[model samples]
Target: MSGIGVLREGPLHAAVKDLLARPGDVTEVKYGRYVIDLVRADGELVEVQTGGFSPLGPKLDALLDEHRMRIVHPVPAQRRIIRVDANGEVLSSRRSPLKGEVWDVFDRLVSFPSLLAHPNLTVEVLLCAEDHIRAPEAGRSRSGRRRRDPGERRLTEVVGSEVLASPADCAALLPDALRAEPFTTRELATAVGCRMILAQRIAYCLRGMEVLTDAGKRGRAPLHVIAA
Candidate 1:
């Protein structure tokens, strides 16, 4: 098994520990500001950085400067590093070129939801490209034909018919008081649980039949009231 596969075997906590344990020039500290994952190497702070720009970046920079140490931020392989000077002016950046199985593992293993929900960690997923990855297919049945139960079919048909028939039935059942009162296309639609466009068409038909009349415009939308 690859290193990435081994890393993926355990829970997130163990996976993160394994990532930090990789032989490097730096020694990782388990916790830092707000108990987030932090590492130290040769007195410099090392952080695995993901997501986009936010206040946390500046705050971490400030903390590192306060401790008189430099920071090494390992960003995702596809992302570009952003550098801000002492005055917060963007200095320079280069697109990260390192791509491998381990990088993919790192991307998936990181719990973005947990990080975003953290009270102290204000990490937010912005402009993520991972949605482009296609979903895996589930195993297919041996026989190609799909089978449907009769009860399920009847239930589905009933639900579909009700959804299709409700609006027309509701319009037919409109109270005499409401039908007599002046209403807009939208108001009538709201009362009948139908689309405004459909309501307008119905009102137009009713007007031609002398059962409804256009009561002029309410703002840009048309209004209709019952005709005597």
Candidate 2:
């Protein structure tokens, strides 16, 4: 085991870590330059990455040569915002109107599109319910007076989780209308109900995973189709 212990993890990390661990498996195993999150019963390495994937690539590349690795990343399906005072007292709590979908993971996946293609790698995207804490940011209100600070948001809880594995799983996220059309970032955005930038990322990852292929051009936008 590495010097990093489960007891030291934050609210979200610790919760997800405990959820992924089995009865007899290990937590925080030191493997070469990295400290793995969990070592499963069959020697599979489970990594719970709560942040961007770009920095994880080199470390994973080193491990995947001989080990089976799974990247467990969480996407909050439902989020509650908890406002706290400077002294850490809870002020108010409310649910954010925006609910997250599994498709949202593409936003982060765009940062490292190639990882989806690693043969020895499997990704387990966990859709979860979480609480976000913040101190009001310093600013003025709509009336142009000094406004209460809305603090920086930090993850404070993990309420639930589910897995999304394989490119087929991601393909399922495409809406029926979009799945039938030649893929364009615009069509993808409309289908997924996300911004074009995020849709572009999803397309990039799908392409890297060999799930989509260039199907020439429709007007100016490059066209794509599900890979045959």
Candidate 3:
């Protein structure tokens, strides 16, 4: 298995650090082997926990039973909630209804610390969808044409948002062949590790931003280049 490399502290840790640096009402607590990030918001105690559910789940449930704070679990899309309860008996259990929209799940998860700390706090579960969820490939027919499968279709559609690189970065990363001359959407997509549709969207956005010039169509394919 690939292991993570340790690097100097950077901006990537900003999100976690910012949460830990909250005002006087917020405090970090250590219980057993776990560190609980806690805060009081609107008179409610909020607790934030990360990592896998196996160990964390039981501990959080026990804490909730003792303190009676509401609990929220942000789990990967592939995982479903098995149970939640004050005592040994389960209060609720099921697959999370929320799938896709990762930001919504993260927002709820981050807010849990304050929510749990509240005297009258209510428990909530925020289930996070897995990153890089693959879109199902279109089925192929015997005749070699693509076929639509309704059952396999995802409920959420992924759309291209922003380019991974700026215009300068894109220009620097382009292959020599493409750098010397305008390239087709297919060529750009291959170079950029993205779908043709996403490449087209990036080209359109860059052209609109005056970072790329559209060099007219080559047959049915469009061409693009860095703006002079």
Best by lDDT: 2
Error of model 3, residue 28, in angstroms: 19
lDDT of 3 by residue, 17-65 (tens): 2433446544444556544445444333454333322344555654655
Which candidate number maximizes TM-score?
2
Model 1: lDDT of residue 112: 25
lDDT of 2 by residue, 1-228 (tens): 455756656667767878778887998998877888899989999987777888777877789879888888877777888887789898889998887777777777877666666666777767777778877655777889987554433454445554545677667666778666686888888878888888888898889877888989989999988865
Q: What's the lDDT for candidate 3?
A: 0.44
Query: How accurate locally is residue 198 in candidate 1, as Cα lDDT from 0 to 100?
Result: 54
TM-score pick, better of 2 and 3:
2
Clashes of each: 2, 8, 13
Ranking by TM-score: 2, 3, 1
The predicted structure with the larger lDDT, 1 or 3, is 3
Candidate 3 lowest-lDDT run of ten = 152-161
Off by over 4 Å in 1: 1-172
Shift in Å, residue 222, candidate 1 = 2.2
